[model samples]
Target: MAETVQAATLRADVAIIGAGPAGLFAAFECGMLRLGTVLIDALDETGGQCAALYPEKPIYDIPAHPAIEAGALVAALEQQIAPFAVPRLLGRRIERLQGSRGAFSLGTDHGDSIHARAVIIAAGAGAFGPNRPPLPGLAAYEQTGSVQYYVRRKEAFHGKRLVIAGGGDSAIDWALELREIALHITLIHRRAKFRAAPERLAQLEAASGPGGPIELVVPYQLHALHGDGGTLASVEVATLEGDRRRIEADHLLAFFGLSTDLGPVSQWGLQSALHHIQVAPSTCETSLPGVFAIGDVATYPGKLKLILQGFSEGAMAAHAIHPIVHPHTALHFEYSTSKGAPGSRDAPGSLAGAGHAPRPAAA
Candidate 1:
C-alpha cells in the first residue's frame, strides 16, 4: 500500500478515533494486551454515533442480547472498560493524518494535536455533514466558502439572517436549538410533508406557534445563491407554482445531507471507495503492513458491519498481535456452556420441569 502522511503530530502506541463499539472494542483489545491506547472523537462524550443519532432505537443484533437501545448498549460497553483507563480525546474533528504505518501524527479542529504509533480510523461515513439546498451553485458555495455545516459557537451566527434548509431531524432540531442565537431562520423544504416523527413536527409547529414569525417555505427549491465578495447575500428560489423569488439572508445552513471524503489514508494504495476503508480478511490489516482497520468503516472479503462482528474483529485483531504483546497467551479465549443432567453444575437453569412460564412474544 502507498503512504500519505498528512498528520499534525507524532508518537503513539495506538490511536483509535471514534468511541463507537468498534473503536471501543479495539481499546478493549489493547487493554487485554496492556498496550497504551488513545481514543479520539468529535462528540463531547463517549458512545459516538449511537449517543447522538439514535439513542432510543433498539439494536437487535448484539450477541447474546436480544435487543438493546443505543444508549444502554453504549453504557454497557463503557462499563466493560471501567477498569481499563483508556485515554479519551473528545469533541474534536480529525484535521489531518500523516506518516507511515507504525507512527502517525493527527491534527484536530479544536486546535490540538496528538501522535500515535498506529491508528485505527473508524470515523463512520459522513461526519461534517453536507451543505444543503441540493442545487448546483450551493456546491460552488460550499467549495468557495459561503455555506456552513454544524454551528461552531453561539456567536458565529449571531445577528445573521439565516436560511435553514430541510425538514429532517437535524434541520428542525438544530433550528429549534439555534433559533435563540440566529437573527431569523428561513425553514425551507422541497415537500410540503415532512419526514420527521409526528411528535417532533408537532412540537416544532407549536414551538413556532401562530403569531410566531418563523418563516417556512414549502414546495420550493433553491436554484442559486447570489452573493458578493465571497459573502452570502441572498438566494433565488423556484416555487411550486412556477414563481421565482429572491430572499435576502446573511448565512445558509443545510442539514439535508452529509458528504464524506476518505482522507489521505485512501491513497495508501488500497482498492476501496472514497467513503469506506478496506482491510485484509482474517487479520483486519489494511493493504499496508502493521496498519489495521475496524468497525462500521471497515470492509474486507467477508465482513459484516455490525457491532457483534466488530467485537469479533477487535478480538481477532488482538489475537493477531498476541505473539508480539503476550507470547504465552493461548490462541483462543476460554468459554464454558452448561448443557447437562439435572443437579449437575453444567446444567443450564430451565423452568420447563420446575415451573410454568408465561407465553413470550413471538420468537
Candidate 2:
C-alpha cells in the first residue's frame, strides 16, 4: 500500500511571495498597517538573488550607504523586520493559487497550503537555476557534494584543493575571496581576459604573483573528470592548442551564471510580459483583484528595475491592500515619524492590541 502525503495549511492576512529585499520590506509595511503577514520563498534563506547568487559582492547603488555587501544588506533587512515575527515558508515553491480577492489559497510543491486575504508576488525574475557545464559525469560528482555552483558558505572550502572554472565575476570574486581559506586555488578560464570588474581582475592578477595561493590556467577548457565512486580526485583540461593537462583537486566550483524561468507563475491568469507580471502603476495590483506584483517580477510603464523602485512599489501595494483586508474600517495614513515605530506604545494600532475583525456598523 502506498502512503498518502498530507498538505500542511496556514492562514494570514497577507501572503508575500519572494523573501528578497522587496518582500522583506513589504512584510514590514504590512505589519505597520496592522495586517497579519507571512512570507514565502523558493530559496531556503531570505535575500533572494542577493543572498544566493552573490552574497559577498558589494552593491554601490543602495541609497545612504556608499557600499554594502549583499549578505550584510540582507542581514540588516532581517533585523529591521524582527518585530513583525513574520512566518516564512522557505525551500518550497508555490505551485498553484485558488480563490480570489478577500480570500485566496496557495498550494506549494511540498504539499503545504496558505490561506490569505491578499497575495503579493515579489518573486524576482521568478525562479533561478544555475547553468551547468557540459562535462560528463558532472552530475555524479555533484551527488557527492564535491562540486559547487554557488558559495553558500566560504568556510566549507577551507583547506581543500579547489579548481574553479569560468571567467565571470562570480568565478573571479570567489577565486580571490577563497584564497585565504582554501589549501590551494587554481582558476581555469577559456580566455586570458576576464569579464569581472577591473579592480577585481587586477586583484586576481596581483594575487597570482609568485608564492600566492592562486594559480591561473588560461585559454583552456575542462576536458574530463578523474574520479571514482562520485568522489573527484582531479580534473583534465585541454588548451586551444590541443595540449591536455591534469590538476589534482578535491573540489570544483563552476560559475556559469543562472538561467531564470517563470515556473508555476506562468500558469497563473495574471497578464505577463517578458516573464514579468503586468501591474498597475497606482496600486501595483495584478489582474487578480487582491493579488499584487512588485520588484523585478513586476512590469509597469516607466518601471525601473532598481531596488529603490521596488521598495516604492511594495509600499504602494501595502496601502492598496489595506481596504480589502479591512473593508469596514477607514485607514488613516500617517508618516512613520508621526506614528512612531511599530509595536511602540505611541504607534497607532500597535501589534499588541491591533485586531483584524471588521468594525461594527454605527448604530
Candidate 3:
C-alpha cells in the first residue's frame, strides 16, 4: 500500500525524519555526499529532543571535548547542517511513508507527497506518549487541550496559567523549569514520590517557601475537568485521603514519557526488528538497501540513546550511504566528513557533555 502514497512535500536523494542531532547530522552527511536531502520534523525547530524538552540540562559522556548544554549544542549542530542547505519541513507531521529507497513517497499534513529513494527515521522517543500512568480525566484533557504530550516550546504557555501531570523527573523538572514563565502550576501526581535526580529535586524544594512552590498536589488525582467551550478553566482534584479541591489554570502540561509509532511507514515492508527498521549494528543501513536509521530511534547491541550517539550514527549512516550512492568511488575514512565514526573521538564538536554540566565548553 506504500508503493505510491501522495500528499505535498519535496523530492530528494535522502529524507530524514526528526531534526534531532541524528537528523541534523544526516543533513550534514548528505551535503558532504552532494546528495539532495530533505529533513522533516514535528517541531518547528531542529535538535529534536535535545533542543526541545531539556534545553537546560547538561549532557556528558560524548567523548573528548568536555561539556555543553543542549541549547548551545543544538545551535552549533544546526549551523553544521546549514551548509547543506537541505530543504526543511518543520511544524508538520508525516502522516505516512510509502515506497522504498530512491522511489519513496511521503504523506504530509501540508498536502505534499514527496518522492525520494531513501529515508532515515530519526523520530527519537518523543513522537508518542508513555505506557504507564492512567490519569483521571486525561483522555478528555488530551483531546480538549488540558493535557499535552510535548514540552519543547515554552513560549506558547508563557504568562498563562497551567497545570502539570506526573510526579516523575519530567513532571517536576518541567514544572520547576517553566515556573518562571508560567502563571501557575498545580502538580498533580498519584503519589508524593518523584523520580527526578536528587539534586534537581533539591533545587525544586529550595524554591518552595510560602505557598509551597506552585502547590504540589500530592496523593491527588484529577477527578474531572470543568471548562467552557473545551477551554480548561479549572481542574477538579480528589486526594486519596478524601481531600478535594479545584485548581484554576489556563493549560496542562503532561511530561509522561516519549515514544514513536512509526505508523503506516513501518508497513512499507522495510527490514525491521520488532517493527523497527533494522540496520547494521554499527552502520544504520536497513536490510532494504539504501534505507538507514539514526539518532535516538535507531538501536544496536550497545547503542546509547544520546545526542552524542545520534551524531555518530548520522555521520556513520552518511558514510555508509556515500559508497552506495557513488558505487565506483572508494571511501576514505580519514578524509570523509565523518568525524566520530563509532570508535573515533575526532568529530571536532563533541556533544559528550551537551547536557548542562558544572562547566561549559568553548564551541
Candidate 4:
C-alpha cells in the first residue's frame, strides 16, 4: 500500500529517493525514530527491481529465511513500513536536487517538488537495463518475445525449448529453475567456470550430465540467430577456435547482467566514480552533508553489493539523519523489541505527529 501525494510542494524531514528494499526499510527506521519521511521512485511501486524485474526469482541470501521469492521479500518490507503510513511520490524521477544540509529542494520530472531537511539515496543500480547480446535479427526476436532479458512470467515458457546464456548467477539460477518446466534447456557460456556460488555450481554440474534436463555448453559464445518473422528456430554458437554449432531453440534468455547509469544523480555535485556515489561506510553519508547514499548505488573502500547489506546501510543512514532532523534532541538508541512499533498515523512517534507533512493516507 502507498499514499498518493497531490500537494504542489510536499514537505518531510527526510526524503528517500528510492522506494526499493533499502528505501522502504529506511522509511521504517526513520518512523521508528519519529522523523517524517516521504518515499519517491521513478517506478510506480515500492519494491523497485524486486517487484518490476525478478519478482518470481528466489533470493537465498536474506537473513533468517532459507529461501524467499523477490516479490515476497518486498511484500514483507511493505508490511514492516505499513504502520508509518508513509506518503509515496511514485512514477516521478528526481531531476534537480538543490539546497543543502538542513534545507533541500528536489524537483521531479513530473514538475512536482519535494522539500526535505535530509535526503537518502538508495537507488539500486540507478536506472538499469539488461545487457543485450549483439546478434543479428535480435530486435525481431525481442519484439516477438522469443528473445527475453527478464523472466517475469515463468509459466509462459512452460514446455518450451530455451537457450540460457551467461555464466553469472542469473543464467545458472534460471537454468536450474526452468529445468523442471522447460522441455529442454541449453546453458551456454564463454567460460567453463561459472560465477555462481559453489553450491549452485555443483548443482548445475550435476544437472548437466548425460540424459539430464539441462545441457551445459562451455567455451561457446552466441554468434547468430536463425529465425524468420520474429520467430526463433535455432541459435548459432561459436568457439574462439573457429568451431561453430547450431542448437535448436524456441527462445533465447540472455542474462548477461545489467547496464546501469547514475543518470541525473551524477550531476548532484556528490563524489562519484563509475556511476556509483561515494559515501562513508559508518554513516552512509555522502561527501555532501545531510545527503547519503546506500544500496548498490553507494560505494566505499570495501562494499558488498547485496540486499542484506543494503538493509544495514539504510539503518545507518536513518540514524545519521536523525540528529540533523532533531538537533535539539539527544537520540538514545534502543532495541526495536523495547520501543515496539508505532501503531497509526496519530500514534506517538508517527509521521503525522512529527509536524512535517500532512498524512496523505495509510500505506
Q: For each of the candidates, give the backbone clash count.
A: 11, 0, 22, 0
**Candidate 4 local lDDT, 107-217, one digit each (tens):** 888987888899999999887788999997889899999999988889988999999999998999999999999999999999898998899989988999889999988
Give the whole-model CA lDDT for all candidates, comma-separated: 0.64, 0.86, 0.67, 0.88
In candidate 1, how many Å is residue 43 off?
2.8
| lDDT by residue (tens digit), candidate 1, 343-363 | 233322122221211111132
Reference-based TM-score, model 4: 0.92
Question: Which wins on TM-score, candidate 3 or candidate 4?
Answer: 4
Cα miss at 63, model 1 (Å)?
2.9
lDDT of 4 at 191: 82
Q: Candidate 3 lDDT, tens digit per residue, 1-363?
A: 001222344667677788887787777766655555677777777777777666755566556647776777778777765544456777767777766555777777776556666777887753654543455555666676566765646777788888888878778777787788887777888888888889978877776556654778788876767776667888778887778988888787766666557665566566766645557877787767677888665666787766777777887787776665556768665554454432123443232311111111122
Tell me the TM-score of each prediction against the true structure.
0.54, 0.82, 0.70, 0.92
Q: Rank the candidates by TM-score, best first.
A: 4, 2, 3, 1
Winning candidate number (TM-score): 4
What global local distance difference test value does model 4 have? Answer: 0.88
How do these models rank on lDDT, best leading?
4, 2, 3, 1
Candidate whose lDDT is highest: 4
